[model samples]
Target: MKRGGAQHEESIIGASLVAATLGLSVPAMALEVTPYGAIRVATWWTSSTYYNPAGDPLHDADFTLDLQGDSYVGMRVKEGDFSALAELGAYNPKNRSAGVELRMLFGEWNFGNGKLRVGYAPSPYVYRSEMIYDADGGFNGYASLFDGRYAQIKLSMNNGFYLALMRQENVGLAGIGATNSPTTNAGNGYINTPFNMTSTTYMAGYTDFDTFMPKTVLGYEGKAGIVTYGGGVAGNYYKIRTVAGNVQTGKDEIYSYLGFAHAKIDLAPFEIKVAGHTAQNLGNLMNNAAAAAGSFYSNNPATGKNAYTYGGWGQLGYTLNNKVKMFTGVAYESNEMRGRTSDDRMAAFANLQYAVTKNFNIVPEFAFLNEMRSAAGTKQERIYATGIKWEMKF
Candidate 1:
């Protein structure tokens, strides 16, 4: 029986070798596929006055357990110089029920020293940081200056230069009863300004097809020994359409621009990163609570221009052995609109991450924010959270 089994095994090996030599191997013709996912559980607390002003003032706090942060699944494929990726995650801006959303989907074709890519992907303007415990690092920090994913076509060189053309969309509407209000039957519209100039109302312009255009970006990155640096600039165009009782009256266009720079250094056990940006009509990009794209206005009806803004963030990280890490960072942004109250936002955070296993981690983090000013009045908020995350690959 042992001799018969050995003979059968030899016959199988010989047949496989012959098939491979004849170009008939099924395995060799198959494409490789990989899958990955993560799950996270966190308990979070926030000052009730900050998020719920109408509730009981005596309670003063809100808390909940969430499983939405950093939970996702992705797949990667590569065949020679061509590759593609698709990643999805649970996202809900209103903090209601979690909804599956596309995070990344792109394909690249590499040719020696350069590459071309198309689809929805991360903006090249972000600076990578080691902070892992906070949800706002990339979304609310300096990276927020140009943080949203975009559908674009990009060309990049190995030496760190890149350019992209992206689609732009309108995201703001004029406040109720303003001149630009759709209900107003006027050929020209204006965003109403307070008599005392304490607040400015953002206007929603017309969405005529003729006013739409593509945005452009140009950037470069480089490294020298322990230090790395990069920066980019972008130009955007926006148009506001005048409404006369639901009829198109006239249209006005405005141009806005942004510029940013970032630098990072690695020194033994610690790493530090600093980044900053200045922009006009960038509230859409920054995702701040009190600002939106097209929120900044010149008040002059003829120009109908958007306002400018600026902000920056910095972080320092220390690695304490392979199992533990620590990070601290500060971020601030201010709107440049005149006579606007509480238009500045600021935050600071610190956290400790401990690796419980190769695929599991525990992080404790603290965050604070001062809403320099908001529609709800100035309020200070605090967040304390402990997160447990597990990641795996197949």
Candidate 2:
């Protein structure tokens, strides 16, 4: 019986070898798939009073409990040199309708010390802060340069060099025409100034607003011993066909540019991260709060003017032990616009994370935000918030 079993095993091995030599059917390497996610919920007692650009008080303090926008589910697939990822983010789960949307979906090909990545993913230019305020918002407008996610094609090398062409942030004009609202109709438009100066009139509307080229970014990242650092530059261009009433006016060209850098240093239980940027006509690069406060774009497209914005943030973290960690950070940003009061903002935050288990944590935090200067030179508002966030990962 033993001799017969050995003969059968030898026959199977010989058949497998023959199959390989003849390119016959054979079992292939199995694909690897991993599903992972995190659920985050928090309770916040926030107090603040909002003021308009004119310094008029608008709203009072409030308190709320909700799910953090960072809560998400993701899947990763890998097969040898190729890999893919898909993630969905859930926002405002406490609302009647939870906002569930695609956060990232991308595929990458690895070849010869570099990678080719394609599809929608977080912009490589973004270096998020450690601030956990407002569900890890990282004080986006106040200091951090978060370009958000975009559909892009990126090429990155192992040696810290990368380049990408991404969807352009289209520029638009508002508060134009006779009325305070934007006008799409063809007519003479007037631009109202915050100051007592006379209003500027122009061909009221623009037609054929388009960007001829995609936004481009070039950067490098490298690490040595206990430190990591990188910097990059980006540029974009767009044009608009101007119109004075029904008469076709000349076209206006707009250009946007940005330069940014960041550094991270780690030593044992201590770590530090710092980042900063300076830019012109950031347009859609920043969020609504940042753009509105900074007056990032020209009020009148005809002027072809762009404002300058710059800001930075830094954080220090300390690990107390295997189950506890603490962090503190500050962020500040400012902008200078022509014919308007430059706006500046600052924020400070501190938090402590306690590990409840290997896959769960409890974080208690406090944050403060101050609007030092508004575009209209008004004292905007100050916010103070204290909260506890609970998170579970799988």
Candidate 3:
């Protein structure tokens, strides 16, 4: 009886060991990985009076053939509740082969009817136009407000509502204008507001300024029948300190905010979209040519007030056949500052995309940009560009 009881005990122990070994050997959820990329090249001719100021000589029209900066390669990995994406942009319009750029690198997790995304990725607040004229989408400057990709921590619901905390820029310099590199004549139409102090990029010093918090972005989007719509608002705050010989004399708190909305309707062969925004001190938060044209105002240092900007763009697209499609759009933006000069600009574009195959597309597009208004004593320029872009997706 004792021997039988011992055998029974040994059998129970063996069973437990086998069960533990099987649990250890079984692999966790298998990760599914996918790779994707696209290659794009554009050869086009462009003519513009943008670079020629009043006293500058007339420049000849220029032609260029280069890789579109938007081309990218990326990998997506998913493991049960977790997913990640790493993408690298292929080219830089400014320098074709400078190096690959980190377009997006982020990890996301699905939890409790929501998603948590962390790292550098496209801003949740971004809405782009279908104007495929330049290497990047053409109307990004004049109409659409693209905050670009930056570091952020975002939480989004399955219901299309999201919030994010993004990196902040300390735009506290006095007499600030032209927030970004002026690639087009958009910047040429502006004269820096007259102030006793010149523009400086010294916002990082302890005596210069203080960024109180990250930029906050909140947005929501959803589809209702054949119509889709979305909108969001963003804002940031910073304080600028006056330091004379390393002694803090005074400080000023600055606040910037913006609100944007977009709507689209799809009916068979016809598609329509419209988007717009209104903002104060837009350049302090993001970089866009139109935003730079209407950035913060410090013309009167003693009575400084932020600049304001408003603009909208609309597109009408039609499908001609299985292989061809046509799209036309118009965009306009205006910048105003009380007690100072204001600026306005308008743009229009038309394009036809022909699909040679499911993966190949040829788009011939034409675009026009006009500076509708400029400061006193400044000459505005008109720009015209026609180009063909070849894109292949894999």
lDDT of 2: 0.73
Candidate 2 residue lDDT tens string, 112-140: 79999999987777888767777777777
The clash numbers for all candidates, in the given order, read 8, 1, 0
lDDT per residue as tens, model 3, 1-394:
2567557645644654454455445556365666678899998898887434554535458899998999987777777899888777764787643455778989999997999999998766677766887675758778678756878899999999999998665444444322322222122221362221223443322334455688899999899999999999999887666545455555667788889999989986999989999988877767443455556645456434777889899999999899999999999888777755577778899999999999999999999987755633255777889999999988
- Each candidate's TM vs. the true structure? 0.75, 0.80, 0.80
Q: Model 2: clashing residue pairs? A: 203-244
For 45-71, candidate 1 gives per-residue lDDT tens digits of 665334455432233565656664456
Runs in model 3 lying further than 4 Å from the true structure? 1-29, 51-59, 95-98, 172-207, 242-251, 297-299, 302-304, 375-377
Which ranges in model 1 have alpha carbons more than 4 Å from their true place?
A: 1-26, 51-59, 93-98, 128-143, 173-209, 247-250, 284-304, 339-342, 375-394
Stretches of candidate 2 exceeding 4 Å from the true structure: 1-29, 52-59, 92-98, 174-207, 242-245, 248-251, 284-292, 299-304
Candidate rank order under lDDT: 3, 2, 1
| Comparing 1 and 2 on TM-score, the stronger one | 2
